[model samples]
Target chain A: MRRSALVVDDSRVVRKAARRMLEGFGFSVREAEDGEQALIACRAEALPNVVLLDWNMPVMDGITFLRAARAEFGADRPPIVLCTTESEFSRIVEALQAGAQEYIMKPFDATILGGKLAQIGLLDAAEVPA
Target chain B: MSGSSPDTFAAIAGLVKARAGIVLTPDKGYMLDTRLAAILRRGNFASLAALAQALRDPRGEPLVRDVVEALTTNESSFFRDGKPFEHVKRILPALHAARPAGARLRIWSAACSTGQEAYSLALLLADQLPALAGRQVDILGTDLSREVVERAREGVFSQFEVQRGLPVQMLVKHFIQEGGKWRIKPALRAMCRFEERNLLGEHRGLGGFDLIFCRNVLIYFDTPTKAKVLAALAAQLAPDGALYLGGAETVLGLTDRLVPLPGERGVYGPAPALARSA
Candidate 1:
């Protein structure tokens, strides 16, 4: 089965870029413009195995969504990767502490993104195309 | 604010730094209050001052340890950043080529919380290094917390745990869906081992490693502790091996035993001293 991912960001370009990147890596991608929409989508459908969350979204920020998701799903929540431009080390630490499984700084290459997914055991070697 | 005293806070801070090499800031007073409130209430202490007195007593040894554990952050997950594993994959063939016949290749995931980091490496090795399928490859994961180690050994994860950094097909292939949780497949689980070992304590008999990922764990240590741990890690590194630290961490001024390898960001090579000696 093709793995599914929910790409949540405020920017259309980022969402489109991430969707393309995830699809190229064999993921069936879903898009949300903001954290509020992402949360609604999560509760409305079968949750995606992973969520690529953006930190600075309007209406609901990544941190608020993270807390809410943890509350809703408890320990069963999907893995959330915070996709942000925040380069401060303290903020990265804060995100990890707040239950983000991983943090990927913005402007990431697709190959690097695949490797991150693979490192977390999300991408099996057999699954990747030759 | 009942019973809070500067002396008590100072003593606790000193002990924590001495034991774990963490620097406790004044701002952490809130953290102390929040974490230690339960213990204070249980002991019938009305103030931090009373709790401090108890901590000074001979019977407070275990309490101190608990306080340290409570304050010490152990946040982590498998395959923390994506690029490092990409680097691992790119370098694996060369690493395999350099190995001597019959020599076992080992990898260590220091501060491996809940086993994700170590298991991630094992899965990657199993998938990419075909020659290692039946070979003796040791993947060891160690953490300072017994609680986290126990969780890692179980090889069970909540949907959330498996979701983070995990892809769908791999989830289906490498993990078994059991109720609301996911369990790692036996074949993948068998490739890795987990233990509880303090980075500051005596070195466990972990044999030499081809790659050592001592990532975010080192950021907590002060300079002296970081230097000591780096030296110890270097001692267990193969001459041509690599070490991966957190993105924010570097060995530049800490030790000359680890020289940065070009084209590999956040990775350091064994110092020339060890390379020449080997």
Candidate 2:
């Protein structure tokens, strides 16, 4: 029962950082540079258990991917969490309305990321290796 | 301290246990260097050795209090561990039905660091139990630290704090966003009150509670202290009321006054034998 994640962001640095953290939390992670690539990954491979999405990316942004993913794959699976610099309440409300399961502000460390994963029930089976 | 000896750690541990009743095992000596670094800078003690040496005097109660406060970890989040809250939501209807008409259902959040546990309950009652309106519920959040109590009373949380363990929808519904922060709305704030009260200090003045949450606080105490605190908390619970402990904690050997509430982990009620005797 290996849990997998899809990390979608324009910056390789952020994807690498999130990949390292998610890997530490026992998630097998895959990277997608933008939303179109993420959708291709979703369609070609099995849906990930969770998606760490970045907003404002070039070519299909996160919200577009979210809506499209919901329309095609369904809204509930592969629980999407919006991870970006967007701290605006309106943006958060919009993300949740668009079908994101949770929201994480940028500059989050391992603890914040881990807590959000746990909150969404993604970390239930994957215990962080001591 | 890199230069300090184990005796310095031993001395500080002794002082903390004597003053605050918190057991600091030798393995946790590493925590002193980190947790006390700020106090060392503020007090200009040069090193933990100097602080431990200064604590040798009997009249250093204020400094001892500061050290104790710093050493006590305040790690908490909204709806932490999640299960106890689910159980609370499930049992609330039956508990309310058992009460007399219009009687207030009181809940005590002991050691309510930064007030998340108490405020989480308030949010749950407001969101889940619409039939029981505002005035019918009373949530009391108490802690040993005055600083945290004041912070809890303010009902303000940083973005980082609000993000942890809080559902996105609840955050939108119950909190108002300030610049870079969120404040629990007045409606939710009005349902709860925060106080600086110690579990070991006194309890006669605090009235009985229909549900008590003394989670994660008792783990820092030694066995005898754990038994004592359990007895005292049990004293404040109504006969049929529920008491929730941390998932890692139990009353197995601590006290006979509390027995596990059926079908839930870390939940306890007054021992039927003890309740009947009373």
Candidate 3:
């Protein structure tokens, strides 16, 4: 099945690039500029299968959004993949504990991203890793 | 309750029920106080009475709507439960078999908060219905709130949104990492549309749907409103079509036009009478 994803970040360039990459892999993409916008967008559409979220943003940050969304969406919440530059093991554990399903560091290779996507089950095995 | 009078409580309760269809009891005064206290503070009112006075003013109609909207929770997620999609899997094959060649297959998600439920359905169809891959399949989602509808159209979600109920495999297949968020690809999104629609109002323009999912929304309505919404849904459903409600909801006592589909507990089929009538 073709999967749909919601990419939340503050940077337009990042949103565009990610959109391109996902589309290249045959997945559909949606964008949000910040956490509040992302929360509103998430509520506005049919829920995407996965969410690519940034840690920091204006208005509402990633962690706060995660807590609220987890409480609101309950067991049906999407599998969250944290896309951030924070690589410290403590930070990763904090994110995982805060409800992130997976973590992808910044400046990641497209192939590595694809591998991570595949590892998470958003892509099929035959598809080349990002 | 300190300075609040019973008369003020009655008036506020009446307004809530009339405007938002929320049936508040006298015992819920504390809830009323808590929910509206912020409004009072924002308006610079000293007490709930002052807030109620403003609410009763014709000028405060918008404020009333805002209050109700604020109080009405918009809690939702994508792929809420795993089983509904499983049922969708079974129904798709049957729907394809029942449909004529090249005919469009349509699904409407009423009260599609954000777009999770609708997209979840789209993913299921795309994955399971290969014959339908290139066919004309319209997955339309509608909600009463304009803000929610606008967000649904944008289709952006956070890490938390992605983690709710989605499987990791679906995530990898469907999403791309951008910054710290994941955005749905356009192709998957292309199959669906979102609109602002109030189920209690007229649905003349929305064409007949092969499957209508009004999950988890009816619990907010009173029995009469539920009956009205169900009747409207029955009118929009095609013969042999199905309806899915929240696990806690049922049409058994509320309406005769929807009979529980065998083997699927929450799934209901249109009553024979409605089928023949339609």
The top-ranked prediction according to DockQ is: 2
Q: Name the better of 1 and 2 by lDDT.
A: 2
- As for model 2, its CA RMSD to the true structure in angstroms is 2.6
In model 3, the Cα lDDT at residue B276 comes to: 42
> Chain A of model 1, TM-score against the native?
0.91
Q: DockQ for candidate 2, please give it.
A: 0.51
Per-residue CA lDDT of candidate 3, range B9-99, in tens? 8787777667656566677678766777777777798887887788888888777876665555577766665567678887887888888
DockQ by candidate, in order: 0.06, 0.51, 0.03
lDDT minimum window of 10 residues, candidate 1 chain B: B160-169
Candidate 3: segments with Cα more than 4 A from true spot: A1-130, B1-5, B27-46, B274-278
TM-score of each: 0.67, 0.91, 0.65
lDDT of 3 by residue, A41-120 (tens): 87898777888888888888887777777877774377777887674545666877777777776765465456566657
- Which segments of candidate 1 are over 4 A away from where they belong? A1-130, B1-4, B41-45, B131-133, B274-278
Q: Tens digit of lDDT per residue, candidate 1, span B86-178?
A: 888887777777877777778898888888888888778767767554566778888877778888899998755665566444665587767
True-structure RMSD for candidate 1: 12.5
DockQ-based ranking: 2, 1, 3
